[model samples]
Target chain A: MKNSIAALYLIVVAFNFSCGQDTANQVATISDTPFTPELLVEDVAIPWGIAFLPDGSMLITEKSGELILFKDGQKNTLSNVPEVYSRGQGGLLDVAVHPDYENNGWIYLSYASEEGEEKGGHTAFTRAKISDNSLTNSQLLYKGSPNTTKGQHFGSRIEFDDKGYVYLSIGERGARDDNPQDITRDGGKIYRFYDDGRIPEDNPFVGTEGAKTAIYSYGHRNPQGLIKNPKTGDIWDNEHGPKGGDEINIIKPGANYGWPVITYGVNYSGTPITDKTAMDGMEQPIHYWLPSIAPSGMAFITTDNYGADWNGSLLVGSLKFQYLELLKLNGTKVTDRIELIKGLGRVRDVVQGPDGLIYVGVEGKGVYKLVPKK
Target chain B: MKIFLTSYILAVIGLSLYFFQDPALEASMQRGNEIYADFCVTCHLEAGEGVVSTFPPLAKSDYLLQNRAASIRGVKFGQQAEIVVNGVTYNSAMPSPGLEDDEIADVMNYILNSWGNTSDKIVTVEEVEAIQK
Candidate 1:
């Protein structure tokens, strides 16, 4: 009887272990690629964002609040850049050029700002025009309210859709329980605004009572990666989960991406946050990473620069594992995940330049351009 | 009978003293553990064994053990300078976690005592507040 009970106990333990492992959606494997990385710009600490200009120049944002304009093989530190709150994870976060930059000459920046009466700082999105290596006529588009001093979770990625709509994601600022589930608050949300920073009349929460009107979606953790799919014009984002639940979500207006309520992750102490991964109203992620690759910058390869097989695949930077991940997609479904550019220092951001080449940003290092071997 | 009673009393006292710990420190360590899970665990990892060459380990860490004030200052402000840990040089920047003084003290106490480390001294909020940038 004693032997039989011991065998049953072992079987139960094995069953529980397998059940835990089954929750992890997919694992990526490293594969060889035809591209080699060449250092394009050097000596950037925590290169957070990279934006290419119309004249083939590049604009990069360092986490320490410096904006660099790389033109003519020289790095010029642009002046008149707005002051940023350079605390923990807060700083100048992401930058993007307007879709019709040639016509309007507008560029957008998202940074952690201590503008309001709040003691610390919160994520702020602004648009400005660049001339003579300086920002002019800068306008603050959106500022998250009730600033917090907590150092983590400042989701500030900028993207523009085909309709010229600007979307900015703000993290929960480490207040997961209060901010993510509440629409009246600012953090843990993606906001949609017009090119001129006006809230769209048709935004999902326009008429809702006490709503933040600009909220496009709520119930997000800390989304650092936001992009507009060039082929479909749909917005997609990847967010950092607590321990194991890093997720890539397709953005839908007014949708609740259940965060603290239902999660594939737990507290960093290996304590479970929730038992349920699915609920009625919460939208599930298109893809999620177990053991969290700590994904940051995101881009979709639109050109055959590397080859036809590379086109339309998603490239995401891994901050924890220090590599770039390629997710093979089939109509909004991630079919396979392949690791590329392994052993590069903490990949911070990835962007596809206008010249049909890929650019990656690394922490404590400079940006590198991936050149296809001829 | 008198000798037996005296020995039993001594044994009970010894065991009680051995098992007893300051309740306040215990409470602070508990809170600190939660803070560590939320903030520090991402870079330092769950076991305090930070990523090699990227983030230095806090498990049985010589740097943390030797430099108490500097460690507090690193947690209070951001750590940017190069420092050697266990004969490995780590130059990466650790941004200020922006934690409050009490939270920093609690986390310090928790890290000081966790992961095969022991500290007789308890970190206090005053100690954290005294640390300057």
Candidate 2:
């Protein structure tokens, strides 16, 4: 009897030892620099898109449809904003200042609003001039088409090229079948247009029959971040892919990103969404994250104010793990990745401030700046 | 020594039986907490208070208390269009948690009891299975 009890104890102990799991929330980095986070502003509601003006004041869009200009330690709530469908994952989203804002003063706003008389909402892009914290000459730039009754995916990120063109990314709006693959309607396609809203004639599908003239690329799931690569003059987009397949891809004209067809991710219910990981004509991700980071806003680090080693790295915000991901790139490929600054709440956006410091926007908390350790 | 060994063996078996014998409702409720943590906690929050005006409150929700059948159906399947919970209407889609019948019952019990809610009866698996649409 004593021997039986001893044997049972040994079996339990061995089982426990074998079942131990790795629970580190952060991935190891190549060479991580120890830094500190400084709270810049507080008491803001769901700060979504953040852009700095030439004068250094920041334009931030709250998800609850309020636009505020934060400058000099004060938040000026602007009015004359359009009504937004401020429901689950739908509201006032990304904001951008025009490339020639100093001379033209054109400010852009992306929001989820009612699709005319349609049952659901569509992401609408509008541009205006900011005068004394008020919006003027606010003209509707473009609206994503074929709205349906869903609120989950509204990929509304805007990036401007140095060559007087703009790039806009829209999500599939849960319409996976006819949206991402079908080029006739605008759902999961990236649009390239003149800054004033004219569809570029050189856009990938401009002259193609039954294809949306504004479409630059197709087959994107929910591209949340769009930025122009400073070195190569290319567009880089980072998007959330179902459960695990978050991907960062270099955008090409008329490229098929392979959303539902080929994915490294599965459905949220843990079932395989696709069996094929790669196929013909579908561009693969330059970098993919398994066990999704729920990627949101992203920015390229141009300055090395933190250090020269940190210069030219890409900073991505994670809504799932609530951390910042620093991707060290070898040219266009991500060679190394590291998770930084955990336990800060859901990171919504990571942008470079006018002062060359990295500023992050959190969902519940206010903006935080990464400053050199004193 | 023989008598002592007999009593020890009996005691160990009795303890094992007792440890495995939890009331059905309590076991289900406990399992439901883990399921809730995995699925519902992100948008609804941990305390079930949910995001204001965006996600409808689940804590002592009058809508859940008044329309138990509809609530079960809403959770078991999916809820779309619009729903008025405590005078506030939510127009967003609440995706089905995509759980088994037993899991649905357990999560229902866990939610209906937590956060100031009161219930005299446990939500049975059969009750959840019987809920249509």
Show where candidate 1 strays beyond 4 Å.
A1-31, B1-38, B80-84, B87-91, B98-106, B121-133
Docking quality band of candidate 1, CAPRI definitions = acceptable
* Model 1: lDDT of residue A332: 86
Candidate 1: interface RMSD in Å?
2.5
Off by over 4 Å in 2: A1-26, A29-34, B1-133
TM-score of structure candidate 2: 0.73
True contacts kept of 1: 0.40
Model 1 clashing residue pairs (backbone)? none
The candidate that achieves the highest DockQ relative to the unseen native structure: 1
lDDT of 1 at A121: 91
- Tell me the RMSD of model 1 versus the true structure: 3.6
Clashes (N, CA, C under 3 Å) per candidate: 0, 0
Estimate, for each residue in A1-374, the C-alpha lDDT of model 2 and write its tens digit: 99999999999968954542223222664345556788887866577899999998898888878898998989889989888865446788999999789899998888888858776678888899988778999999899876654656788899998899988888888788879999998878788889999988788887789988888998999899998888888999999888768889899999999988998787765678888889999999887786678899989888868777778989999877678988877887676678788767678888987788888997666788898764
Worst 10 residues of 2 chain A by lDDT: A17-26
